[model samples]
Target: MLLCFALSRCAVSPTGDKLYITNLYEDKLLTLARDGTLLATFKDPALDGPYGLYVTPAGQVLVCERLSFSKLQMDSEDRSKLATLATRERDGVRYPMSVCYSSTTTSIIVGQWVNDNILVFRVE
Candidate 1:
């Protein structure tokens, strides 16, 4: 299927061979080859309105769930493991629209779109 709307953010794999895209309207994540070949589509109820996407050095895919204001992490290759790292109401996240994992600092940064703030959390 062609990605037409709500294509929020994208990230390239550490190896630069794959592309990961977040579709907010469709509530799914798309994996594509470097040559734009469709590889896989990941859809889950927990993945509501995914916006920003980041590929960590360890090959973890981090996604920002816009409407939910949550951060989700999954295995980049297969998305076998999915976890909610944070939430707005419980974790002080307010409308998170973007996310990035810092290997050097061992932390995750979330961009709070509506609240106009940035939240940083140290990862263990």
Candidate 2:
């Protein structure tokens, strides 16, 4: 399938106070202040290699990793740990490279890196 890919490697919170960035080679996620000061760095077992990111309208953070069995993980509201959004099989997408949430449609959209495909999951 011919699909458009949108990389989401960095994002700013809805409040505009913080920035979230993924280090593609280091397997780490960084949180920064608007002034470019590092606030925190997170490393999660769920993340193989961080690639892309998406911040929800409500300020929720989601990450896309590069491994074949990669994930779409949501950052806990406290910005501490990452929680998997769904099981691997249920995600139905491989090699995720981008993530986005649609409030109007109540859905999650995923883009792949290894292949030209986009996955859309409705959120209830």
Candidate 3:
């Protein structure tokens, strides 16, 4: 799908039908149908420099905010102020540049870009 704004990150819904795209420049999350129709826009909890995103089995959205443009560390302790933050789990690990739930493995594999390794977490 052609994004009016550069798509910094995107995550397919668990149903594999919808998509949530993060527009870094616009600081907005655009929800789109499978056919690329704009469904809704969310504000307030605006994402900053969002890099990676994923949808959980329970249908919750997860966004990885890359602090300082490319750094993986948390920008702040509060997390909300940090440039790199996970919107879903409070205790979610850091530097999750990529994530995927594998049915075969039954685990959530998190790709740490800078770390150059995949962290596998069992998903019940």
CA-lDDT, candidates in order: 0.77, 0.68, 0.57
Question: Regarding lDDT, does 1 or 2 come out ahead?
Answer: 1
Query: Where is model 1 more than 4 Å wrong at Cα?
Result: 67-77
Q: What shift in Å separates residue 59 of candidate 3 from its native position after superposition?
A: 4.2
Ranking by TM-score: 1, 2, 3
> How many collisions between residues are there in candidate 1?
0
lDDT score for candidate 1 against the true structure: 0.77
* TM-score of every candidate relative to the true structure: 0.87, 0.78, 0.56
Candidate 2 lDDT (Cα, 0 to 1): 0.68
Off by over 4 Å in 3: 1-5, 14-17, 44-46, 56-59, 67-94
**TM-score of the candidate numbered 3?**
0.56
**Residue pairs in clash, model 1:** none
lDDT of 1 by residue, 1-124 (tens): 5557678889998888889888888988888889998887888877788888888887778888864433334444555435677876678766787788888899999887887788888988
Top of the candidates by lDDT: 1
